[model samples]
Target: MHLLVCGGTGCRASASDSITESLKERLQEHNLQDEVQVVMTGCFGFCEKGPIVKVLPDNTFYTEVSPEDTREIVEEHLVKGRQVDRLLYQAPEGGRVKDSKHMDFYKKQIRIALRNCGFIDPESIDEYIARDGYFALGTALNEMEPRQVIDQIKESGLRGRGGGGFPAGLKWEFASKNEADQKYVVCNADEGDPGAFMDRSILEGDPHAVLEAMAICGYATGADKGLIYIRAEYPLAIKRLKIAIEQAREYGMLGESIFDSPFNFDIQLRYGAGAFVCGEETALIHSMEGERGEPTFKPPFPAESGYLGKPTNVNNVETYANVPVIINKGADWFSQIGTEKSTGTKVFALAGKVNNVGLIEVPMGTTLREVIFEIGGGIKGGKKFKAVQTGGPSGGCLTEEHLDTPIDFDNLLAVGSMMGSGGMIVLDEDDCMVSVAKFFLEFTVEESCGKCAPCRVGNKRMYELLERITQGKAEKKDLQRLNNMCHVIADTSLCGLGQTAPSPVLSTMKNFWNEYVAHVEDQRCPAGSCKDLMRYEIIPENCVGCTACARKCPVGAITGERKQVHEIDQDKCIKCGACLEACKFDAVTIK
Candidate 1:
């Protein structure tokens, strides 16, 4: 039996390394070192229950494993062939799940970009080779012409997974057609979405896959040099990528004349300062060229002139992760997976309000309901489902009406949201719509490159308007003004950062008009999330003459005699909810 422990950043932080060590020591003590192999692999995507330990042969998936559980795992599972009942993954429905494939969290997930992530030791090139890692690059370099390779990718119907669902094959063809002395292929690993780690996780888990795909892209685009512009914040991913690149070079896979062929391609790493705008191809190219990460107008698009003014093709990490797979697996095989328009799979960092918060990949046509209910294990704490925010800060909030909508590029766009690097944040009824809009606007406002007036001034203005609405200080007519300003920002913004900055406000206003109206017309926050819009009241009958709230009131907001019903002075109340928590009787309530 082989023991695979999650070595990804999340699991590692949770002491998965110590778990691996303990298991190894126990294995040696039991004289099963040679018979059983303990391998530390990448993330398993079920992050909520990590650090994960999956026993192969039977695929007995264990979760929330600590260093102390290592000996138990070895003695019970490895030696006696009995699974550790406590370590085994228990489903939300009160049953132990031995295999991950049977769990709701992974049942609907079709992992393509993340295929070898949790299964293989990413730093080992031989392990990567065993999984047919560089075969696609070798095939393209040896047998297939550049145009033919491009044609195959086009036929696969793969779209870029890095926010914009642009056709990947078409983008490559654009750079391929452009003739220049030197050309470049770029992997945009500078993922900056607030809760999105799709790109970073892919790099940390499957670095070799990205390298192979980059080499293939270099061959197809007639680019001799490849650069990965990853954020400096991802030290683990950066280290693993550096190791993977060095291994590829040593194996004669990355350098010139690979497979005894004339094709010469090598990859290098460029670090970014984690600017959100740099996710844009032009801005990324500019950052690589030692310029500010701000975006310039795209008349001379990155494909035409980029990175020192040469033909450069830029695709994000998840997009590149799919390239080798599509090349190895036939175009028809890949094209058949999803809908006609949007093909293949999308990797999502599923977070916020969901029970099974983790990294998940699903086919393009999978419904939001399937993702939320089945794959995500439904909303947390049995809370009423409110909305889901897709496409990161730039994407819009979607409601229950959109849950059944097929999750493709066009469908999400039609619903006032785009699939922006696959950050699906599920919202519950407790989440205030107006507050949610303000939150995303705040993020966009802060992350804006400030190069264009629309993103800089307009987004700040939009954020201010959202703030007014959330704080219950806005007029009803302010909604119309907010709507108008959002359109202006979308129409006039120089890049996507400004263009989609207003999406959250517009979408929330469209879906949760009543909530916004409550905050405005009634001067109340419906979800009680906005503290300024909430009034703390003491229930007259339920108070039971409790003095606890009065004593605990930090600002002397509550006033009453001892053993007497308490009353709150709204003027003194800071809306901290401390009185509510301090109340012994169920006396305090929010109005």
Candidate 2:
């Protein structure tokens, strides 16, 4: 018997740390600690009801467990044989209480990429071993040939998950086919996309999963050393990774003579200093070698010449997570999961206006409707779904019209969006499309490595255009200029950073053109988002005033006598929303 508590970032924020500590203490007190091993695992997804707690053997999933309830869990379940009925997830539609397996969110997901994410304690090598960790490396070394392993991956139809969607096996073949004395295998764990935690979560939850997969990759590609280029901001992930590597070395998994095999493969960590542009392969390689994180033109490609000018193969965390599963299950079993072009599953950090926001891994061809409605539990506040911004800042927004579009590499590309590292941010009608575009552009401008002139200057200028539009300083010519810059940046930029920087602006302009037009032509923000176009006005009819608004205004913009209607000084108003909160009668209205 085992108890798994969600220790992922989201659950951590919700006080799962206390729950874990309390559960451990309570179990020890009850003296059932020997019978049921309590494990602090990573996210169980289903984040809406987090922090999640799962008991194995019976597989009883308890959602929203507070620290105080840890005693109840230990006493009732450990002492008695009765299952706690009230703690189980109450289905959104109020049906019978079911376990995690019966839930709709997990029903559609075939978790090839996230197989070990929620199930095992990342810090423990034994838990990882229970789930068949290091088995793939052992199998590869003992039974199979290196070329045969590569060929199996080639037949699996797996593509890269790091936005580019290149063929994974083909990329490996490129590195393997290249004859070099010193070769490299880099796990591109520097996941910099906003609202994307799939890579980070995998590293935090299942660091050994990546470690084993990278070893498999090293043996397949004829490489002996592996490097995980992870962002420095992921402190927990780095800690877990270090622990896993040390354990593997102690157990003869990472260092020389792994399971007494002739093949030698080991891994090291290179910390990336939070550069969004460094997510690019070449730039990541450059940063790893203590150079500036900037992308170079890809002619030689990472496979031919990467880290220290060696034959290299770089795949993101999600891509590598699938390698072990693909090898163990065979290419045919893996290929049957998704569409013809995109094989296996994709993990997405489903965030924004969605209710059940969490880490989800769905089959490749599943429609956005299913992801949004079935898995996500629909939009929050019952607001109408406006658009979904896929692929982070680089990828475009998809409107209601594109909801049914199957989520695959080529299909997403066909509609001006790419399945970028799977950061699916849902938006509702209240979210201004113009603001959304500007916000992404702002992020891109800040994160740009500024390697080339077009990306450096063009993206900043494009962001300026968006700023002007939102500020009502934009003209008709500005729209034409925005369109022109989009093409220029896309065509002339050095790498994917510059090339896809214009996606948000272009996507919004194409899908939400009317909103952009209103901002420019009418000089008004239709969605009431732009503060420059809005003023806090007192509703005299609803106001008892009572000097509350005047006293509460931080800027002293409001002036009023006792129990009199307040008048806001237009020049003094900063639109900080202080007066709106202070007014008891809902008198303050933004116009």
Candidate 3:
């Protein structure tokens, strides 16, 4: 019997480490330590149901278990051969979530991009090997030629999952087609998208998956050296990747002739200084070469002239993770999974106002309804779903009108949203659309590499217009100016960083124009999110003047004597939301 404990970053925050240790202690106490393997595994995509403890052989899935439950789990399940049904995942309808394979959330997910994520103990090389981790590399070395490997990927129709949707095989063919003494394979782990951790989690949960895939790429493109351009903020992913690389080197899987083949390749980690624009291929190459992180015009794309003017191929973490799967199972098998254009499943960290918040890997053509409802379990608190934003800060918002649309590269673009690194942020009716647009604009303004005036100045100007509108200081004419500027920025920007900056504004305006109009025409934020246009008030009947709201007010804005009605001083209230959070009387409100 095996017990897999979640060791992903999100679960780690919720004290999953304590749970793992406690489970071990319980196993030892019950004398089941040797019989049962308490394995620390990568993220189980059902993060909302973690810290998860999944018992294998039976696949008895347990969710939201505390350290205390560890004792009961060990005693009852391990000792008595009975399952802890209560600890099992709860379905959306409130009954127990199924333990059987058919009923699991993973049943609905086609995990091509996330094949090894939840299955393997990321830190251990043996566990990765047990699950056929390096089999593809072995097969590639002994059985297939370099050209054949590239052909399999080409036949798979696999495109880069990193927003651009460029064909993976085409990119590899470009590099392979050229002959160079010193070529390089790069993994773009510089995930700077707002609410996007698809790549980050893959690196954290299955670092070896990428490492192995990079080795495969090295063999395919005849590159001896590889580099991973990961952000410095992802210390956990970096640490795991470092361990995986060292382990691969030791095992003769990564360094020197792997599987005794005539190939020697190794990967080095490159730390990105947290620049959002550096996710671009050219900018990533520049950073790797010890230069400033900024993108140059493509055409002499990274496949041809890249990384010290050598032939280089770059694929984001998600793209590389798919390599082993394609090689082992065959590209024809992968091509059958998703739609014709977008083959295989995609891993997404479903976040924001969704009911079930976690990582999800669904087929490419799955409708937004299935993602937001069937898998996500719908919006939280029964709030109406206003929109779902895919593709991070650069991607635009999709409203209920577009919810039925199938999710793929072309389909998303047709609706004004691009696949920007798989950050799907669900917004509710309570969330002000104008504010949402402004927030993304702010991120772009801050993260812009300042390579061109369009992104540097134009984005800041657009943000200023959004700020003015939100603060009730601008006319409707300002909206026109922002829209006009968006077009120019999209057209004039050098790289994708500047070109896609206007997406949030354009998408929000297209879908939620009413909210923007209401804010501008009536000088009222319907969502009550704009602090400048809102005033907090305490209703006399609702307030018992219990001094609760007053005491909770951090700004000393609430004033009343004992049991009398209290009033909020508008000037003093900074709208930190402390009073609202503390209020049990339902007295505090924003206009």
Candidate 4:
């Protein structure tokens, strides 16, 4: 029997390490340590109830487990074969889910890229092998030709998950067609999207799977050398990747001939400084060549001239992770799972305001409503769902109207959003759309490489306009100006990063125009998020005249005598809401 504990970063932060130690200690005390094996695996993806401990054979999933409960888990579940009642996942509606297979969170998810995660110990290469890990690489090298492998991928309809949605097979075919003495396969692991940890989690959980897929890519593209351009900030992912590479070499799977074939392949790591612009292919290529990470115009795509001026093929970590599974399962099987245009499953870092905050993988045709409401366990705190931001900073905000829309690349694009590296941030009723637009614009302004004037200047201008609107200082004409600038920037920008920077502003304007109008015309923030547009006042009827609000006012904005109604000086009020928090009688209110 194996006890798998969630070793992913989120669970680890929530004291999973202590839970593991406590479990081991308790198991040892009962002299059942030898009989039972406790393993620390990567993310289980159901992170809302994390520090997860799953018992094998029966597959009893224990959630939100603390160190104190470890003894009961061992004694009752491990020894007596009785499952812990309270630790089992309880649904939001009602009823306890003893089995993960029966849980709503895991029901719709089809784990292809995340197959090995939360199932195996990532450090152990043997564990990966036992799960048919290297079988795809071996099959490609031993039986299939380079062209045949490419054809299989083409038939599978696998598109890049990293923003562009370019066909993976076509990219390899393009690289294979280009004749060069040395070719390269580059894995873009420098994931820069805010609220996104999809690539990092994948690398941490299934490092060997990436290595195997890279090797397959090398054979298909006629590239002997491979490089993974990952961020320096991902220390745990880097460590695991290094270990996986070293182990693969030791097992004769990565270096020289693989599966006793004449093909030669090896992989190395290149560290990135976490530049958001580096998510762009050309900018990433420049960074790898020891130059400033700025995007260069592409007529000569990376397939023709890339990585020290050689024929190179670049694919993101998620894209490559799917290759092995597609190969092993065959194109027909994988293609049948998703929509006609989009094949296979997509992995998303499901975060922000959602009830179930974690990682999730669903078929390409899965509706946003299902992902946000059912799979994500609905909006956090039962708040009304306002909008959802897919595709990170570059993507647009999708409203309730787009709830039933299928989550494919083209579907998302049609709705003013794109599937940008699969970062889905859910926004609720309390979130201000104007403030949201301003937030994303701020990110783009900071992350813009500044090579293109449209992104560097136009984005800054857009941000300023959004700021002005949020502060209740903008004229109605400024709204039209903002719209025109967004179109110009999208039309003129050199790369995808710059082109999509105005998506948030445009999307919010389209969906929540009333909110923007309220900010400007009425000089009010509808969500009460913008401090400049907020006015704190004392409700005379509700006031008990306790002098609490008056004393707690930071700027002495509230003046009153004991047992008398308090009045707020709007000019003196900083809109800090300090008085509201201090008033036990609920006298202070926002105007």
- For all predicted structures, in order, the TM-scores are 0.83, 0.83, 0.81, 0.84
Candidate 2 residue-wise lDDT, 279-383, digit = tens: 899999999999998888888898899999999999999999999888888999999999999988999999999877999899999999989876776677657
- When sorted by lDDT, best at the front, the candidate numbers are 4, 1, 2, 3
Put down candidate 3 lDDT per residue, 219-257, tens digits, no spaces. 999899999999999999999999999999999998887
Error of 2 at 211 (Å): 1.1
In candidate 4, stretches whose alpha carbon ends up further than 4 angstroms from where it belongs are 1-107
Per-residue lDDT of 369 in model 3: 83
RMSD each, Å: 8.3, 7.9, 7.9, 7.7
Residue 413 in candidate 1 has what lDDT? 96
Question: Worst ten-residue run, lDDT, model 1?
Answer: 41-50
Q: Which stretches of candidate 1 lie over 4 Å from their true place?
A: 1-107
Pairs that collide in candidate 2 are: none
List runs of model 2 lying over 4 Å from the truth. Answer: 1-106, 562-564
Candidate number of the best TM-score:
4
Model 3 accuracy (lDDT, Cα): 0.88
TM-score of 3: 0.81
Global lDDT of each model? 0.89, 0.89, 0.88, 0.91
Off by over 4 Å in 3: 1-106, 538-553, 556-567, 576-589
